[model samples]
Target: MPIVYSEKEASLQEVVTIQEVDDLLEWLLANTDASIDLAECRHLHLAALQTLASARRKVSAWPQDEAFKGWIKPLLTTGE
Candidate 1:
C-alpha cells in the first residue's frame, strides 16, 4: 500500500496513485486527528494530491525529494 496506516498516523511513500486516493481519503476521514508523513514519498498522482490538499491533515514530515516537496508543500499548507 502506498499509504501505511497506523492508529494515528499515515505515511505516504513510493508512488501514490489514483487507486490509493479513495482509501487515503477514507483513512483521513476516519482518523480525524491523524498526521501524515511524506518523507519517503516519491510521487503523487493528481488525485492523491487533491486528496491531501482537501483533507487538511497535519503533515508530520515533508517529502525528501526537493522538487516534490516544492510542488506539494504549498498546496497542502495553503489552508493552514
Candidate 2:
C-alpha cells in the first residue's frame, strides 16, 4: 500500500500514489500530530498534497528524490 498507517509512530508512509484524498483526509483528521514519511514516495497527487498542506502536519522524513523534495519543500515551509 502507498499510504501505510503506523499507530506506534503516528506516521504515514507515502510510498507510491496517494490517490484517495478523502481517505487521507479522514486519517489526518483522526490522527493529530501525525507526521509523514515520504522517503520512498514516487508520486503525490494534488489532492493529497492539498490535504497535507491544509493540515500543516510535520514531515518526519523527506523523500529521497531530490526533485520531489524540491517541489514539496516550498509548500511545507512557506507558511511557517
Candidate 3:
C-alpha cells in the first residue's frame, strides 16, 4: 500500500499517486500528530506532495534513494 495509516504513523511506500491525496489529507486532518514515513517511497505525485506540504506534516523517515531524498528532503524540511 502506498499510504498506510495508523495511530502514530502514515507510511508511504513504493509510489504515491495523486489518487491518494484525498485520503491522505483526511488522515492527516484526523490524526494531527501522525508522522509520515517515506523510507521506501520511490516516487510521489505532485498532488500528494502538495497535500502533505500544505498540511505541514512531520516526516518521520526519509527515503534511502538519494535522488528521491534530495528533492523530498528539502520539501519536508524547509516547510515550503
Highest TM-score: which candidate? Answer: 1
User: Candidate 1's error at 4, in angstroms?
Assistant: 0.5
Q: Which ranges of candidate 2 are over 4 A from the true structure?
A: 8-18, 78-80
lDDT of 2 by residue, 1-80 (tens): 67777642333345444466777788788887667777777678887887888888778777788998999877865353
Candidate 2: minimum summed lDDT over ten consecutive residues — where? 8-17
Rank list by lDDT: 1, 3, 2
Residue-level lDDT of model 1, residues 1-80, one tens digit each, is 78899979999989999999989989989998998999999999999999888888889899998998998999898455
On lDDT, the leading prediction is 1
TM-scores, in order shown? Answer: 0.93, 0.80, 0.92
Error of 2 at 40 (Å): 0.7
Please list the residue runs of candidate 1 whose C-alpha ends up more than 4 Å from where it truly belongs after superposition. 78-80
Clashing pairs in 1: none
TM-score of 1: 0.93
**lDDT comparison, 1 vs 2, better candidate:** 1
